[model samples]
Target: MSTLSLRGIVRQFGPLRVIHGIDLDIAQGEFVVFVGPSGCGKSTLLRIIAGLDQPNGGQITIDGRDVTGTRAAERGLAMVFQSYALYPHMTVRQNLAFGLENQRMAKEEVARRVAEAARMLQIEHLLARKPGQLSGGQRQRVAIGRTVTREPGIFLFDEPLSNLDAELRVQMRVELTALHKRLQATMIYVTHDQTEAMTMADRIVVLRAGRIEQQGSPLELYNRPANKFVAGFIGSPRMNFLDGQAVGGRSVAFEGLPNLDIPAARETTEGEAVTLGVRPEHLAFTDGAGLPGTVDIVEQMGGESYIYVTLANEARLTVRRPGQTQLHAGEPVRVAIDGAAHLFGRGDDEHAITPRRLP
Candidate 1:
């Protein structure tokens, strides 16, 4: 089994501490993604796990064995980096066999792995060609094939699709997902794109600065974010936030909207400052009791439209509706928070004081 565990992991570069007492456990054969913005130490943490970088403290273990002092080559892991680090002069077959040769593995076995990896990645036709002769996607497949031949216990991917174009990235994502299931290997991926993390990961570890803010399934984080950072980061188009005061028992008082009796899973003390969160799809134009705003922009995205509004308090809020929209800029409208609403303590790192956590 390829289970991984990191306990009280800490890292520093001279006097500057980057990772701070991190603790995480990854199950065998699970696809775990580490996601955060740049400088968030995702790549640094991945390197530490891969044994490319040593942590200042804590222990790293694989399958119950303490591997904190193990060499990267002996740790039984292979990493695919952001750049397709293929040797320019080597053919696909040679590149795939190079690592095996360095390990003094049998030539026949090397040939078998190279052939199998090429076949699995559908790059058999490009096996004889050098890296210069392959397309970007083909090159990436070759890069991954190089790792597949290693047959490592865990597959570590550090933004493996970042170099590809948008369409190619989507294609690679599908390929990688299929490959993971085919091998049933434990995979740890690092990316800044939350959409990528959402679509590919069995578990997502949301990191900010250097610490993990929250870790859960894609829907768990989307529906019940632990804090404001996660609430804004996990969803597409992002969740909108408004400043408000908790009042009238389980209700909120905010500018633009009247005191709303929004149900929060957790009860907050009355008069406590809180923030109201609403996703674009949960909001709509209403004729009844609602917040007044003027339409600022209506973007028709084929079968769906995203309507941007300027509230009376000048806070911008987006409402997403299905199909075409008749709304236009400068049109006065009243928007209703129709769907589930979330409440968070004021500021970025507070937990969901409102909305239901997974049952």
Candidate 2:
């Protein structure tokens, strides 16, 4: 079993504390992603797990064995870095065999592992190529193959695709997902890209400042965010938020927006300040009704379009529409928000008031 666990993990650099007490349990063979904005300690936490960095206070365990004080190599974890970290002078074959060779692995066993990893990553044809001769994607595959040759208990990837272009990033994301399935290895990946976290992870741990804000399956985080920050951060184009106050016990009133009835599951007292969140896809154009606005900008993608609308109160919102849109900048439009709105209490500790629901 390759299960991993962390307890009371904490890290500090002089007077600055970057990672606060964090506890997590990762099941064997699960592909987990740590996601957050830069400086949020996601990478720090992953480093701690890999034993590259020590936590000021905490315990790390793998398969129920304590490894907090073990050296990085002793912990039996393999890490793929963001920079690929390949030797400039070595060919792909040499790079993959380098680590195993250091351990004095049997020649036959090393050859077998190298051949299997090369085939698995589809890099057999490029084995003789040097890093300078390979493209970004090929070098990345070689980096990953280096880790595979070791067959470590846990695989740690620190933003492995950050160097690739948009199209290659998407392609690598799919390939990584397939690799996880084929190897069935316990994997932990760290990245600031939500799209990567959403598309590749079996579960995502969202971090902020020095603590974990939330952790769950991608759909769970998207459909039922735990707070205002999470609601704003998880989606593409992001969820739109508006200032409002509860009124008549079951309704909310916003400037320039019609009073909206709250769902019974989301109980709110009258006169309480609240923030209302609606995703762009949830806002639909309606004629002769709903909130009044003028299109500020219209962004057209191949399959969908996003209309940026400015309301009377000067509040801007993005409305997503299917396929091509006939809307244009400065055009008058009215948008009706779907009932699947999210409500959160006021201030920094804006806890969610919206009932958790599946999409």
Candidate 3:
């Protein structure tokens, strides 16, 4: 296990700056995941950590040592890329032993390491097969096994499951988490998929533009997002935002919906413009008064249903309802808030009022 710290990390391409002054500390044996949209510099940041790409500025340290100038080979880290970069001509056994042999390790030690890695990865039976003969998941396992044979201080994964099918991706997620538990090595993973980050990481780092939006446990970010972007980004159905004005100390007045008093932990201004963020799972069809909208569409997805409702002001709202629903298109629906909600100010000014913690 290894600890890492990054200070004032900066990256630029000509005049366009991507990463700006990122300072982060990663503890020993923790699995940290970097998540963001495309072109958000997640991969670039991972590369900088791996010493594959030199940063335009800042420092990288590992285990109390200044390793900013260290080469990738000496960084004590192994990285698995998205493409499962396997040598097609070589069998799995040769591929796993290649790096150890290049270091001139004894043939006995290399063989032992390869055997152990193959056993750990459950690829012992497939050791004689070449990359071209393996399935996508099997090839990925071989790629990971190649890294495991080296036994570096930290393991880095760059969207290593993006190529697999949905079922395979889920299966690999469980396998990778189990692998992390067994190895207990420090890991830094970069992925565009938030689901992957949520499930596999001990902590998730959310990036936007070039800066760190927030970093915390998955439930921490989901339950108490630091800002509007994060509140909207981390969840599956994406929190719905309604433009409204703060009124009556803790209440917000929207045009179509009734004046809703928020359970705010902080005081709200009397007439400040605010956006009310509510998750689809937090809403439900109400028998009494609620947000009046017309059901635009209903997606019956076996165990659950997704209801798309168009509010009176033409804003689209999605409500995730558990189990089957008889509701169809063009039906009138009144949705009420039943769970968590957030409030934000205009122009992404953090949370206008932080919500109260639920019992």
* Clash count per candidate: 0, 0, 0
lDDT of 3 at 201: 90
Ordered from best to worst lDDT, the candidate numbers read: 1, 2, 3
Which TM-score value belongs to model 1? Answer: 0.96
- Write model 1 residue lDDT over 1-359, tens digit each, in one string: 39999999999999998899899999999999999999999999999999999999999999999999789998999989888789999988999999999999998999999999999999999989999998889989999999999999999999999989999999999999999999999999999999999999999999988899999999999988889999999888889998889886667888756777777824888788898899999888999888888999989998999999998889899999999999999999998887878888875567788585222
lDDT of candidate model 2 versus the reference: 0.90
Worst 10 residues of 1 by lDDT: 350-359
Q: Which stretches of candidate 2 lie over 4 Å from their true place?
A: 264-266, 356-359
TM-score for each model: 0.96, 0.96, 0.96
Q: How high is the lDDT of residue 230 in model 1?
A: 94
lDDT of 3 by residue, 324-351 (tens): 9999999998888889878887765565
Q: Model 1: residues >4 Å from true position, as ranges?
A: 357-359
